[model samples]
Each structure stands twice: as C-alpha cells, then as structure tokens.
Target: MRRLFTGLAAGFLLLGTAACGSSDGSGASDAGAASGGTTTLKVGVIPILDVAPVYLGQKQGFYAKRGLKLQLIPAQGGAAIVPGVVSGQFQFGFSNTTSLLVAQSKKLPVKAVANGVASTAEDGADFAGITVKKGSPLTSPKQLAGKKVAVNTLNNICDTSIRESVRKDGGDASKVEFVEMPFDQMPAALAGGQVDAACTPEPALATVKAAGGKSIASNFFDVSPDLTVAMYFTSQQYAQKNPELVKRFQEATIESLKYADSHPDEVREILTTYTKIPDTLLGRLTLPRWPAEPDRASIERLARLAQQDGLFKQSPDLDKLLP
Candidate 1:
C-alpha cells in the first residue's frame, strides 16, 4: 500500500535547491559533497506499492546512518524517471526493470542495484489485476479485441504484463490500443468509460473494484513468470565515481527490505502518508518480497518483453548490464 504524505510536496520543494557536499562517514568510498558533510543522494519514485522499501529507508533513517542524505523525487512514471538518472539529475531512482533494460539496450548508463517487489502468480489473490467497469462486455482478455485499453505507460510493466496476459488468453494483443493514465486516475477514467479495461496495480485496482469494476486477471507473474516489477537504478557514471556510496545505498535498501518483510503491520500503519489509499483497502493488497540482489534473468526477461512490446529496438546484453 502507498502512503499519503501530506508534507511531501514541501519536502520535495525544499530538497530541490539543497547543495551537494562530501561526508566523513565510511559507507561510500567515492563520496560527493553535500551540506553538513553528507553525501547527497537523489532517488526517483512513482507513488505505488513497490515503493515500500524507499519509505522504510527514509522513515527509519537507514540512508543517514550510511553517511548519505537521501532525497525522494515523486516521478510521473518508471519510464519517465530514466532521463533523470541519465542526465545526472538524480544519482539513483526507483524504476521498473523493463525500462532499465530498454534504457541499457540503447547504451544508457544505468544499473539495477536492488529489487523492489515480485508479482504473485495468477489468481493468487493479489491486488494487482486487470480491471473493467462492472457490467462491461469485456469479461476476459479475449473480449478486449480491437478495444481501447488503458495502461500507466506503454511498454512499461503495465502494458507489457497486460499484453502477455492477453496473448496467453487467446486475444490478439496487436489489435488493442493503449492510452496512458496514472494509477490514481484509473478509476475515474474507467467509470467515465475513457477506456475499456485498465492494466493497473493497487491501490488503483482496489479503487476501480470499490467503484464497481470487475477484475478479469490478477497477478503479474501469471502473465510473465519471475517478473521483477520494480528496482532502484544508479547510472554507470555514478557507480564508477562513487562505488562505496552506491554499495552503501544498496546495503541500506536491503536492510529496509528486510524490515518491511518482517514488519508488515508497522508498514501498514504509516502507509497513508505515501499513498492516498484508505485503511479498508489495505487488507486486500499483497506486498511482494524484495530480492536481496538483482536477478539477471528477470532483468533479461524484462528486456525481452520490452523488445516484444516494441519499446526497445534491440535486446541488451544482460550479463554486461549487471553490476
């Protein structure tokens, strides 16, 4: 569940003008200068379920202990965050594996330092699902033929997973048209009949359902097995320039993941601050485990999905992309 932070806007606005400086701490071997002798880190994120670890790290002060002052930037989408890293606007950001893989294929300087969350198998009772308005003619992927479908972004996880599911369900994915919409607005758009179906992750899925939408498919892993839904990225330049700092960032994130895994109840209590999801919707949502290390095969599969979905023109060398 994503938390709703009332003060988040102020936080982002304040951090935007903050200075970069160096720190005396031992975490990052290659440190950059920031205010108060802290190595500043700018991380990009989309307000969604996969951002639990980021919130955990921030609230728990995991980054601070590593001699890093982390700044969180709420981005438009996973794909939209890539350029921030590539252009040095952010040292690292939370992005889906598919986007990172596609970016790497084009020789973008990026690497997945940590895994965010894994999707469950189909019919696994997870909140991630393909939803349509109640009483809509589209009861399954087969009915979506030649219909207008909605995704948060094309070629990203939302569209890719939906396409794969449709293909497996005897639907011609090529015949379907996709339009971009944010997770928060999916319910309104669906209710307004802007699209036939929406491929979304919760609390959007929950929202659509609460507003009388029917779920046709659930679990992203059922659509594509071992899908690495999201991850944190640092450019090749950032990694090379600050090896110890990147490693420290990774270590802190791993610790936060462990805490989130072990303390789900505590996580739920503070979720409203990061996301607008209500407490009643929390029980239905399933938060997947965060991998301790990045899985190369999953990253490669995302690359292949990107290529299959026409997001990337070529497949990247998976082995060379891993840190």
Candidate 2:
C-alpha cells in the first residue's frame, strides 16, 4: 500500500516539531519548549476517507494552535492499531466502534476521546456497502446465502454489519462465508471473482462501482441508521493522567471535523495528499459523516449488536468505553 507520510511530516515541521520523535528520550512529547510547551501525539490511523479530518486539521493548524503536534501512523486496519494504543506505542488511535468495544470487553484500558466517522440519515449517501460485479445473478442481500463475502477485517464493523444486513434481508447469514481483504483491493477482487461480494467503504465503494460493481446493500444503514462507524481513542491511563492534553486534542479534532464537514472540496483535496486514491476519483468518493462529538445512543446500539453477534461475551460498559 502507498503511504502518504510526506505531507504529514511537513505539516508537523510547520508546527515547530518533528513528525517523529528525536533521540533525546522525548518521544511523543518531543515538541520544543519554545512552542508553548506543545505535546506531540503519535496517532494511529487508516489512510481512508474517514481520517480526512485529522489531515485537514493538521493542514489548517488546528492541533498546533492548541499546543499539540500530530504524527499520523498509517495502519492497514483498526484491529492492527489496538495493540499499539494499548502498549503506548501510539498515544492516540482511531478505530471502528466494534473493535474498541471488543477491546474494552476484554478489559483493555482504552477510552474514546472523540468521534470519527458516522452514517448519514436514511436515503443519504452510502458510505459503506456490499458490492457485486455487474450482471451477476445476485441482486439482493438474500441471495448472498452460501456465498463468499469480502471484508477488511474479521469480527469488526465490516463483518458484523454484513451479517446483520444479510440476515435482515432474510438470508441465512450463518451460511455465508467471509474472506478478509483490504478495502483498496476489493475492487480487483470482485472483478476477478475472488469473492462473491465485497463489503467496502468509500472510496473503495466508489472504485468498485466505477469498475462495474453494483452495491447490493448499504451496510451502514442496514446495520443501523445514523450509525457511528469509527472513533478516536486513547488509553484510559493516558487520558486520566493528561486531562488537559486530551481536552486540547478533542477540541482540535472537533474543529477539524467541522471544517471537513463544511468544505468537502478541500477535504477531498487534502485526502489526495495522504491516500493513494487518484485525484479524479476523489470527486466521486462518498465521504463519511465526520461528526464533532461521539453519540452515546449510537455507541450503545453497537454494543448491543456486538453482544448479539457473539463478538463480546457480554455488552461492554458503554459508560466507561465512551468519553
């Protein structure tokens, strides 16, 4: 996968701090004292449309103005970043709500610091879907029974939602097979008939559709209306020990989200710098709903789904999991 660290590195330097830490034992907090005692935060992120706000916030100096320096480390998926956040290798991280809930169920010390991406209201843009190649016999979710489906990660949002969608459409979700594959690769996978269908989010959704793949279902809405797809989080110890830092980070993130919400063109432009999605495809991508604050109801719903899906032995304590 192509990484987009160049622009992020320059953004950190412009904020008067090195993107990565120096050798003086000042790792995440390596900001110079002259920069108003700035704290450098190593953030774990996936290079997808959902994380555009973080990049936009950096480009607009939102975090820097709040005495924070963000170094974005790209991971293949949310599950891969959980260990880093727990180990303090990443001071902050982004992951889907289901992944965090599962981690919290196992008593991981992670707590959400801010909201990331969400689903739109009914009939709004489809940010996530199950795509099948055009002219395929499958036209509805019910037809997916006994068929193979592709998801970025197993036992995460994609897996959970796809099953829920198929079941809701009267299909035997248990009979369906799920294959793990990266979102960016789903388009090719679908075209090559590697999987019967691909569960993907934008711009992969757009990419698959552009390549003659038709969406059989909107996974986000099918799972729940106005679903909170992902969130930003930190270890519970880190948030409690540095409450001020957490507050500043949240404020900066919210500001950036608002900017991305209001300026789609600019957000897409910024995404082009960090993601491998081509400039022409940027205009065709469906942007996820980047809400400024985490929604309690949405999160609670996810926990309930996790319990139903048997991902958690019991529903996680939403009060402790959320910020």
Candidate 3:
C-alpha cells in the first residue's frame, strides 16, 4: 500500500527523523545531518493510539534534544512497513512483536531496537483483550472454542496471544475461529452478533464496553504480565552500519516511553492529533503500559507460542532479532 504512505504523509506535517533506527547506502529517508547537525529519518508507522508516545515524545523535544526528529510514514501492516525499512525508504518501522519474530523466522534482517507498548497485566482491566457481548453465554476464554473472534490482524499478536489465553483456560485454541476486522468496527460487530468475541484495544474496546460488551480474557496479560506487544525496529544491516544512531534512538525512545507512561493526561491529549478518537471514549479507555525496556522473557514466551502455532518456518533467533 503505497497509498498508506501517502495518506499518512498527508495526515501529519513531516517533522524530523525516524530516529532510534537506521541507515542504508542511498539514505533517501535520511536528511544527511541537517538542522544544525540534527539528522531526520523517515519511519514507517501505523496511525493508531498505540503510537501516541512517539508523537508526544517528539512534541516534548525528547528526540530534538538528542539531535533527532521523526518523519512517520503511515502503513497498515508489517507486510508493507518491513519492506519499506529494508529498502531504506523508511529508516525505521513500528510493528507488533509477532511480525518481527515472523520476519526473523523467515530470515528477514529486521532488528528490534526499542520497546513499544504493553499489556496492563490485569484481566478485564487491560487496554486490550478478548471481549464478549454483555449478555453472551461465553464468560471465559475456554468457552471460546468453535466461536468467531475478531482481531485487527489475524495470525499476528492478537490471535497468537489469544490462543495462549485459550490454552491456559483449557480450550482448544485451534478450534477458535478468528475473524479479521478493524478495531473501530468491532463494537458494532459484537453488538450485532456478527462476531462472538474480539481481541481489541482502546478506544474501540471502550466503545464496545460502553455498549455492554464484557472482556472475557486479558490475552496479552495471559501471555505475560509484561508482554511487549509492539516495538520500533530497523534492518540488521542498518544497525550494524550505524550502531551509534541506533543507540541514540533506543535511549531517546526509552526516555519517551517512560515519560509517556508517567504523563497520561498529555498522552491522552496527544491522541487527538493523529487519530480521530472521540473525547468521550478516550476518557473511558484503558491506557497500555509503555515500558522503557522490552521484556525478553515475554518475547521468548511469544516465540514459543508462535512456534507451537506454526507461525515459523524455522525458529526465530532472538539474539539477532532483539537489541
């Protein structure tokens, strides 16, 4: 989706670097030491609530103080974003952990350099989880077998962690049917009985709950209390070529994550900039944990679950994939 790039570009004014990220020979995404020696890098990102911290961080001048800035190009999935980073069109990319692991499994040279977002670790109180209609008979994840469940992306973080929740609850995860749809559509889909359940995050989750939907399981929390759902990544080639740049990005991003975690009001306010989430839903929504470090234990657990689910052609090498 080249149009994803153009649409995302049109949504926000280009500011500065894709920082915490990369470099390639052509360096088309790079500004080549502009802004009084500050480098601007283009980052491939999805325009969603999960990415608010980076925007907030940029506005807070965390990146600027580090001589970095962001140019976030929008794309819907890892399929497009990963390739963009590999091709040097985007110096960095933001994606869920599973996509990066799957890329590693397939021998793609993607490397995770910074933490993204995480689960609240509290069942029924998490930002994202498996939800059911208020009056539905399904009260637990174990009852989810042979039922329709919606997720924004199938076979990625949503379904993978959901399966873990199912298995933990003594259900046959493979028998659970995953229906793919956007998070915004899930509230109506659940209320209308179009899907039995949905693995959704806020603000859509907030919408669903307000409409009498009940979260049956904290899937991400079930996987690990510190489940690192998403991350900011770059190509291995770029990391090797420019370790210092990557390090700066990593440090700045962790600082940003810490800042964002502590400043919920600012984070909530920043969500209005890139996304069209309603103020009413925004206040009710659960904010996810934006940790300063990627939980390696949780990631390893994710890799194991992915392997069990046959997501890998071969086992992913965590040593290479994570920084």
lDDT of 1 at 111: 78
Off by over 4 Å in 2: 1-35
Candidate 1 per-residue lDDT over residues 1-323, each given as its tens digit? 01112222233344333322222112323634423466767788888777777787778988888777777778767776776665566778888777667667767667777777766534645547888998887878767778888877556777777777788788897887888878888888889999988877767877787777878876376545556677887877667777778888888998888888788776666567788999998876666666666666666666676688777677786665665
Off by over 4 Å in 1: 1-29, 33-36
- From the highest TM-score down, the ranking of the candidates is 2, 3, 1
Which lDDT tens digits does candidate 3 get at residues 139-234? 999999999999876568888999999999999998999887777778889999999999877777777788887888899999998889999999
Badly placed stretches (over 4 Å) of model 3 are: 1-31, 34-38
TM-score of model number 3:
0.86
Candidate 1 or 2, higher lDDT?
Answer: 2
Residue 307 local lDDT, model 1? 80
**Candidate 2 lDDT over residue span 201-229, tens digit each:** 88888888787778888887876787889
RMSD of each: 6.7, 7.0, 5.8
In model 3, the clashing pairs are: 16-69, 16-70, 17-41, 17-69, 17-70, 18-41, 20-249
Residue 24, candidate 2: alpha-carbon lDDT? 23
Models 1 onward score TM values of 0.86, 0.88, 0.86
